[model samples]
Target: MDAVEHFVKFYKKLDNQSLTELALLYSDNIVFVDPVRKHQGLPAMRHYFAQLLQNVSTCTFDILQVDKADPTVTVTWVMHFNHPKLKSGKTVSVDGISQLVITNNKISYQRDYYDLGSMLYEHIPLIGSFIRYLKGRLAT
Candidate 1:
């Protein structure tokens, strides 16, 4: 399989057990960015995922589509996760896209684009209601 295919596969099966396989997919000097945080290097990325997985009860990614052009790959996915402190432990689904730059058959850079409010603020109690109301108003 190609790098993009490997990446999608790795993320789909991501969990505590699959963390050790990160090195196989990401370069040593990998740079990872998302709406909430930016991390550089494999060590930093590992630390971030470790903390993230520890807090969430369960997390999974469903790759909806994958497009690649030579060194660049874009993947659309839905992330489903349940956190004890968020949304009363109910599952939250967020749609997002990941842009990856592959080098030497390993992902060297990755950036994810997603709505911060939808993934976070919308899960809060009062804030969630207000955000939803605002979104509804803007839509119509």
Candidate 2:
């Protein structure tokens, strides 16, 4: 399979709890970037996914748009994660665009663009309160 198919397969495997399939999706020196962090190498990527996947009950991706130019593919999708710890204890949809760079039939780099405000800021009661308080303090 080509790099794009490999990456999509990895995401599908994730949703199915087939974590072992993730082993082949990334290059040893892969670079992954997202709203919260930037990680280099497969080890870091694996660690990040391990925690992230385990935190949710179920997750699914709905593609809104996709554009591909040579080795770079950009995809806009809504990823819904249902987790008990979420403030609503319900499905929360986080929408984002991901840019994937395919090299030699493997994903060499990936960057996820998502809003912190939409994914997290307003989700927490105390943290949301703190952010509001800080916003109010600065606005005056």
Candidate 3:
């Protein structure tokens, strides 16, 4: 498969929410970094995904651009979901950039740069309060 094909296949696996398919794209010791947390290895990646599935029911990724020649690729993504635990019920739309490093057709590293507050914590009830408190603290 070509670079774009591999990238799209990765997202296709995500859309299916197939753990087996998703796992195929990554190296055993994949490294993931984002605004909220840094995760290393497949086990850590599974933990991170478990948290995501706990809250989100449906999500779709949109691709904006591709630099096929380079092993590193960047994608624009917007995830849509509802969290049952947040404020009784709250839905969120999150926009972010997913930067991935692919080698030999498998992803070795993936870094997501997105706002945690907007993507998740803010809509939460008690957690939202705590996040707001932290925001206030940072503002000062």
Candidate 4:
């Protein structure tokens, strides 16, 4: 399969165990950026994923669409994860998009866009309530 296809397949079944396969999908000099933080190089990416998934009970991705243009690809997906600290360990779904730049048949750059409030802040008790109230107020 191609790099983009490989990426989609890898992420669809991503978990702590599958993290070892990151090298197959990303270049050694990969630069990854997300709403949370930035990671440079494949090693850094591995460490980041390790911490991100270590406490998660489950994590999955539903790929919605893919837009490709030569060396660049954009994918839209919904991430479903259960975290002990979020939503009482229940599943939380968050919509997100990832843009990747492929070079030498490996992903050299990737940046993810998603709402922090939807993925984290809104899951906190007091923060959730306040955010909901603000959303409600803004909607009216």
Candidate 5:
């Protein structure tokens, strides 16, 4: 399969058991960056994913769209996850896009763009209220 197809399949089947597939999807020198953290190398990326999976009750990605240009692929998706510490254990959906740079059929660089407030800060009680209020005021 092609890199983009492999990427979509990887995320769709992502789970603790399938994390080992990271090696198949990413290169040794892969660089991954997102709103909350940046990791370099497959080992660091694995560590990050391990911690993330450990903290959440469930996490899944629904790919909305995919655009590819040779070695680069951009995918829009909504990540649905439930965390005991966030939103009273309710599921939250975060819309985001990931840009992947594939080299030799492996991802070399991956960057994600998403709202930090929606994914984190807005889930806190008092902080969430304040942020919503501020956003409401700014929207007018």
Candidate 6:
């Protein structure tokens, strides 16, 4: 399968246990970036994913669209996740997109764009209220 197809399939089935299979879709010197942090190399990527999923009760991605041009592919998706500390374990959905560069049949570079406030801070307790209020104030 093509790299984009492989990525979609792998992510749909990804979890803490399946983290070891990251090598199947990423290069050894992969560079991954998100709104929160940046990581280089497969080991760092594995660690980041592990930590990110450690406390997650459940996490899944709903693919919305895919645009490809040779080695570059842009995937727009909505991530739905549940965490005990966030929103009282209620499911949270965040819209995001991933830009991936395929090299040697593996992903060598990946950058994710998403709102950190919506994904995290907005789900917090006191912080949620404060942030929401601040947003409303700015909108008015």
Model 1 lDDT tens row, 1-140? 66788888877866544677778888999999999888999999889889988998888899999988978999999998899988999999999999999999999999999998999999999999999999999999
Candidate lDDT values, in order: 0.89, 0.78, 0.72, 0.92, 0.90, 0.90
TM agreement with the true structure for every prediction: 0.95, 0.83, 0.74, 0.96, 0.96, 0.94
State the local distance difference test value for candidate 4.
0.92
Which candidate, 3 or 5, would have the higher TM-score against the true structure?
5
Candidate 2: TM-score? 0.83
Q: Please, what are the lDDT tens digits per residue for candidate 6 over residues 103-129?
A: 999999999999999999998889999
Model 3 weakest 10-residue run by lDDT: 12-21
| Candidate 2 lDDT score at position 42 | 82
User: Clashing residue pairs in candidate 4, if any?
Assistant: none
RMSD in Å for all candidates: 1.1, 3.2, 3.7, 1.0, 1.1, 1.2
Clashes of each: 0, 0, 0, 0, 0, 0
Candidate 3 regions exceeding 4 Å error are 2-6, 9-15, 87-90, 125-140
lDDT of 2 by residue, 1-140 (tens): 87776666556445675555555777889899998889998888878888888888878777777788978999888887777776577787888999988877778899999877656775788887887787789999
Output the lDDT of residue 109, model 1.
Answer: 97
Q: Write the residue-wise lDDT of candidate 4 on 49-114 in tens digits.
A: 898788788888999999999899999999999999989999999999999999999999999999
Q: In candidate 4, which residue ranges exceed 4 Å CA deviation?
A: none
- How does model 5 score by TM-score? 0.96
